[model samples]
Target: MTTLKKTGARLGTLPLAVMVLLAAGCGTQQAGDTVKAYRRSYPTPSTPADFLCPGEDPEPTAATAAATAPSATVPPTDHYAENHGFRVPIPLHGQNRCDGLTVTERVKSALEPLRKRGDFAPQHVQNVLTDLGYPAGKVYQDGPTGVGFLIVIDASPWCVEGTMSRDSTKADAFGGYPDGTGCEPPQGGH
Candidate 1:
């Protein structure tokens, strides 16, 4: 075969290669790395978590601090992505706002039924989220990276981000990000 044809054939298997790598990397979640403990580790400035909230820094007690100013130092037991491949500038958020944990469940469940249809087009996903009570205008989407895409709903108090992957066969939804707008991953604090 010509060099060009050989290169094309190799490229065709790129997706498969990526899938294999990803599968292997996602071994198993650690016991302590449960979603309940997946705290937001973002907004870490020289002054520790002083830049925690974007606006109106609340005087946090031990009770409310868990929801408001979560630890930016302690990481979840499973730092799989960091060790495996992906390196995020900001940390992942937890389900604490706008009833985020519930919303995340709702979004994940809503997508599950539609997964078999293979109709996870951006607009469709947004519409579905809107139907579930979120604003249509606040939703954001990016990419069909291999067989996946990202969806983040600006659920006001928190950003509910969902990553649809492996040709819509699976999805992982979570809450929060340390963005200035309390939504989207634009980098930096609050």
Candidate 2:
């Protein structure tokens, strides 16, 4: 029974000594030393504006200016003036000079010479003319190479046929006529 009491007293003294050693190891002075070491390693950020402002910008940057810049302006098309000139200045109406049968007959007539000269075939010329909106009611015939027309209904003029020739390999096989120049009328009006 005396040995048991001695053992209990030793155990109580052991817990008290352990608590004192723990308190000394984790003392306020030790905590203060830790705080001072932390301050030296990483101080609280002073004057937070140093992080906020890198430097005063002399002028707005490209990124900033682009965000604030005005939108671009698109230019107007010249088609309206071009169409007016085609109609008013260079009238393309009434009987075509090449053949009497409007623009359609004129194309057929023009193709006759070219076909004979082997520059174009009949069927090819017909197909090309059909694709180009043939029988143009408003006549605007010139040389086969320069033949152009405006539809009776529309303002836009189209060069329907003979703007190019197989004979063009040699310079001016069509009687040395300048490109897009008018040809002299054939004798006896054929």
Candidate 3:
């Protein structure tokens, strides 16, 4: 009877151990999925042709763009700052091109110094954008590669995109880039 009781206790622990292992596996899978989705949503820029900023001439050729743009290796990560911390109210209507351009420029200027230093602080970036009267939205950082920073401005009816790379020392802005697309509100609607 003593031997049987010990065997039963061991069996009960086996199920608990299995459950823990399953939970851990699920967490790992979920993290991988999140990283994959982020990469899909915001692809890594290969050349200047892949991105455009206001007042910049279009790339003459893909080859030329690739040759001119500096190359930086960005790593994949499960961590990201999306819809966290700061929240901007979504406007009733979409923003115009001019508004987009204005916010883009402000973001570019704010991040210029950080690019030079080859360091990016998410909170500082957020504050600068918010102070500039622009919806900071969400900022995503790819570890510490200094590959650059991606700022998604989803301020109702308008979602402007901005990217900067410490390696390239360039800040590119996309005003009203996702205008027609069905981009959900960044603030989850006010």
Q: Which candidate gets the maximum lDDT versus the true structure?
A: 3
The full ranking of all candidates by lDDT, starting with the best, is 3, 1, 2
Clashing pairs in 3: none
**Alpha-carbon deviation at 126 in model 3, angstroms:** 1.1
Per-residue CA lDDT of model 3 for 3-64, tens digit only, reads 99999999999999999987778434576798898899997954322334456456548864
Error of 3 at 34 (Å): 53
Q: How many residue pairs clash in each candidate?
A: 1, 0, 0
Number of backbone clashes in candidate 3:
0
Candidate 2 per-residue C-alpha lDDT over 66-165 given as tens digits, one digit per residue, 9 for 90 to 100: 4323211223256654333312212122222112113434455555565456544334554545555554332333355433332231222322223325
Model 1 lDDT tens row, 10-127: 9989998999897776657765667445555444345322334333246667755654443445565665533422223233343243245455566777876665575657677667
**Runs in model 2 with CA error above 4 Å?**
26-29, 46-190
RMSD of 1: 23.8
User: Against the hidden true structure, what lDDT does model 2 obtain?
Assistant: 0.39
